[model samples]
Target: MGDILAHESELLGLVKEKDLVAAFDNGDQKVFFDLWEEHISSSIRDGDSFAQKLEFYLHIHFAIYLLKYSVGRPDKEELDEKISYFKTYLETKGAALSQTTEFLPFYALPFVPNPMVHPSFKELFQDSWTPELKLKLIKFLALISKASNTPKLLTIYKENGQSNKEILQQLHQQLVEAERRSVTYLKRYNKIQADYHNLIGVTAELVDSLEATVSGKMITPEYLQSVCVRLFSNQMRQSLAHSVDFTRPGTASTMLRASLAPVKLKDVPLLPSLDYEKLKKDLILGSDRLKAFLLQALRWRLTTSHPGEQRETVLQAYISNDLLDCYSHNQRSVLQLLHSTSDVVRQYMARLINAFASLAEGRLYLAQNTKVLQMLEGRLKEEDKDIITRENVLGALQKFSLRRPLQTAMIQDGLIFWLVDVLKDPDCLSDYTLEYSVALLMNLCLRSTGKNMCAKVAGLVLKVLSDLLGHENHEIQPYVNGALYSILSVPSIREEARAMVP
Candidate 1:
């Protein structure tokens, strides 16, 4: 404690009022040097004691005033040396003070000696420093820079400040360049955004037109050709498929056929018949155009269309193929779809089966395919009794029975039993189903082989046909009579039918 007091008294002696006033009055900074050499130099070098540290900072405050006033105009080298000494003192001891109340006051002062004295301040603009430290150092340098530009310190900078000015100017130019680049990039981004919106609008317009054209409104082959041409490319096709809503029933298939269908040449008196081969070649490169477009459109509809209508539209269009061979190629997939848990798929399967039965080749194909025959029989045997499926099965059976080979297959597979069972379930069968079943039965009994098959189940057949005689569906009575008359034609089956009469 005594040593600290002695140090404090000695520091006070160095800055005594008479000596400081005389030094200023005489315009002599030698007194500032005398104060530094006498008491401050050693204290700045080894100022670990609190009193010595306080005296050292007091010396720095006096140097700041001396530099501010230029009272004696210290030599530039001498001023730099003094500032360098003050910088080392502050750096070595500033950290402890930074956490105390004294830091803000010291930081707020405009006179910061020279930023070039501290290494951190010297690299203030370098990115290697932490952002927090760089920010603090930048503020410190800025305050010093502002003070250095003042009338008292302007010459100090004019003599040796070229590097600092250049660093600041370079930073300003870089900021300006960065702002210009940002503006340019922003313009490009905005243009791209605008173009994207315009493209979206154009796509939406095309989708609207496509939907309207597909709905059978203003549908001409040429308009469809134009639309397909517009959507011919894969990218355009994908976009059109995704953007257009085809929820309206049958629209997708209708559009597909409309797009790919050949233009029919109107017959004229003088003109030669239009060469279909050349015309078709010109219309589409491959016959697979229909297949490809149909597959693509059906896949799209599978995702977009309502559950019930999807298979119906696809199957209906599939049935419209000109070549039975072409339809047969896709029959496996259709048969697989028949087994779907969706009632919608099963219903459409029945419609497709009815359509196939209406074609001679399709009926022969179905009758020959035991898998198809079994599927039909299974559908017919369903206890829940779907009327449309049963009706279609009967229609298919009637077609098959017309061909002797198919009739034999039916008997061998015991599918003829399904017809008799349907006939027996008059309470369950629809009027259309009853008519179809009786018609199938009439066809099945026409031949001796089929007669033997029915004779095996003659009691049940006779009973069901006899019950149908008084059916309120008069449409069924004629078919029932025809079936019974055919059954009674075979002598042995006829005797058995008579025995079944109530």
Candidate 2:
């Protein structure tokens, strides 16, 4: 025992000196495996005291190594024996452990390296367990999945198909139930956040795996959307408990940025719905500071990009959340604010209009609101120093004109002249900005009323199209052709358009 203790102490020291991750990275996995074998052999023979002294961090490292390196290799009898022995040791220590310590041992079971060792990793999960423990295990599995292309959890399921179906269903049910309870009963915001975070994390993996491998109905997009709404409402409800001052610079903006950080789930496109009425009345309606903060936050969220190496380039959930849609339809109160005389207010409103224009519903709402359309139209004619404001106002008009009724309203507001002016401007417009312009004209010329509007500006329109036809950009060609076809099909402008074709 004395010799064994000394050997164990020496091994632990060596492990501590050479970190497990560094060892793996340095290609010393075989050496680490040897140390693991020696420690297990010494522990089983040297008694519980020596086993207890083996240290939790050492076990964590071993588990990580199993996950990191133990796949696709042929079965080893010696490794099987040591892992079986280690499982027994772990089971003995796992009773009623706290969440902090429970995950350390539990994380090892699914990634035990030997196919035979974790044949029942799924069974262990679906079996009765504490909610905290279950959530921790689920999060660990998700992290493993996200960290690499091939997760051991996924590998186990792939190799063992029908056996895992029931286990996965059970896990899905548990996650749904846990998410409900967390939102409905949990009062502590941090705890609720952590629970849902893990729940959604597991959900992302489960949804991705089942979709690729299984064809049956597991989790629907609608169900995921509901879960998203509940989580958002919970966060907002908690945030509303305190008095947030929107006036101080960064006060309202900072609160919203932190409070509304997008709910990210790996491979999931679901986003939480925002109650625009509640958000506006409580946060933005009467306060300029709050509204400005919201405007800045929206700009930040829209423009921010992930690290270059990340798998997903954009946050689809944030884009689909539609807070701006809500704000745009708030009884036209937000639109009324757009007409403010203050230049800062006008810039914020312009940016808001640009965001609102991204969605069809928001554009429809703006089109129906006569005052808003007039204000956007007015901004288009004014010569502003800030080109972004003018560009955004035109962008909003393009989106609004996509709807036929809105196009009629916008034509009445003199949108045709502005489109011709921008198209003929000497300065270059971005391909996307140019695309929006051409696309809008294409829509307008589809009908007789708009065709007549095009006829009035036919000479200028033909000149711009003739120039664009010779331009290098190929994307703009289709829209230019569509607009030209719409105009030339009209007997009135056909000859004039053809005359400029050369």
Candidate 3:
């Protein structure tokens, strides 16, 4: 035992020597693996105190090597053999597993490695039983499970015509025990709850992969939709309670959206009707909590790359129901998010407005909502007063007006009112606010009754444009010119334009 310990220490010393790492960097995989294998075997046999640390170090080094050179290489058999040896070493040195509780590298490396070109080495640690190791293994499995290309083991299942539901059920059962254990691990290791959050992210990824892979298969749409709703709701709840910066909270929203993209609407059976009135009542009662969740969900949806999915979800939840319900139930929530200090929320609001404009129409449901229209009108009013939010709000309104011309008469009326009010204040006409206001009015005029309304407000329009035309700002002149063209093209306003020019 003494001789074995001494030999192990010598091997550890050699492994850490800068020259050994350099040799591996120089394409000396054979030499590096030989020394690594000898040291790992000896360490396991001798029960060296630093065996786990050495194993972790080797894993890190091997990962770095694979990333730098092994990507797309055909000769991975040696790499596989080396990983197999390490797995055996770990099993042999089962007593050393408890020595190390941190596997940060394992959790992150899967994301860093090009999984498409280079397979992960996770299978090497499959038999791991420690809470820390199991957590890392779960993440590794999730990364592998998400691969669209069939895995070797899955090929047999595919050939056998085994349904995705069966595969998922099997995987779910496998993960159920792990999930329970992870909760236990969280309680036992509170200091590392953040690490458990990493597990949560992986769990989300697994759910996403299951949804993607099983689409159109025996996996019932109802089941998948239920899973998605639960997952989204869980994430929403957790994010609300915690200060999760979804910008990089490291959750799986992005991945889930990608995976679920192929999902057809039919698969997600129409959501059962909720007594929206009851739901609204409950939301109003729980306004504070609901607002928090809304803000978080908005941030997640807006800041992330999946704004379309986020936008869809919000539409279903807020817009599809009666406009009044949306306004009364979610007005405060939307306002809270819009006014939030977070740039994520602001950008999201911009996207939401744009989407709403594209989809707006004089549907019976939308037209009946006087309160919702008023709220939208109010947003435009407030935006006109504030320079910072003016452009985005105007842009949104312009889109909305174009899409729903009939419903926009009220908005057009408001625009005419604002234009008249702004022209009365000469100082306001000279300011940059006048540019956005004019452009917004131009868009309104392009709508059904907009041309007629422009004629009514012709005097105010010509006054603003005349003042803008004289200004030295070159940029303001073009926008003012465009607004003039839109207004004068209307026959009713042509006489008014000629009078102003003459």
* Candidate 1 off by > 4 Å: 1-332, 364-368, 383-385, 497-502
TM-score (all chains, Cα) for each model: 0.35, 0.39, 0.36
- Predictions in order: lDDT: 0.54, 0.56, 0.49
Ten residues in sequence with the least summed lDDT for candidate 2: 307-316
- Report the alpha-carbon TM-score of model 1 versus the true structure: 0.35
Tens-digit lDDT track of model 3 for 1-502: 9779766755655444444455555545457657556533553425533444544645444544443455577356665554445433433443244233353223323222233232333433333323354344334323323432345587666645655676688899989989999999888787455444554554555555676776754444444444444444344544433433334533335635644436443332221223344434433443343333333333333233233543455455545653224344445444344444445444445445444454443233344445534545565566533444545555555555454643376554566667557655546444545655655666665554766776677787677667767765544554566567566778768888778764
lDDT of 2 by residue, 1-502 (tens): 9779766766664454344335434435356446444534443424433233333323333333333345665246644444454444444452212134333334234223333334333333332322333344334334433433355698666657865786799899999999999886766776766766555555555556577657665554444434343444475745543444443455533554566667655543211223344444523444564455445444443444232222122233333443434324555455554665566666777887776676654565455556677877777677365566667776777777767787787676667767778888524776656777777777777778888887887788788877878777656666787778678877768878668656
Of the two candidates 2 and 3, the one with more favorable TM-score, higher being better, is 2
Total backbone collisions for each predicted model: 0, 0, 0
Output the worst ten-in-a-row residue range by lDDT, candidate 1.
268-277
Q: Local error of candidate 3 at 417, Å?
A: 2.6
Model 1, residue 435: C-alpha shift (Å): 0.7
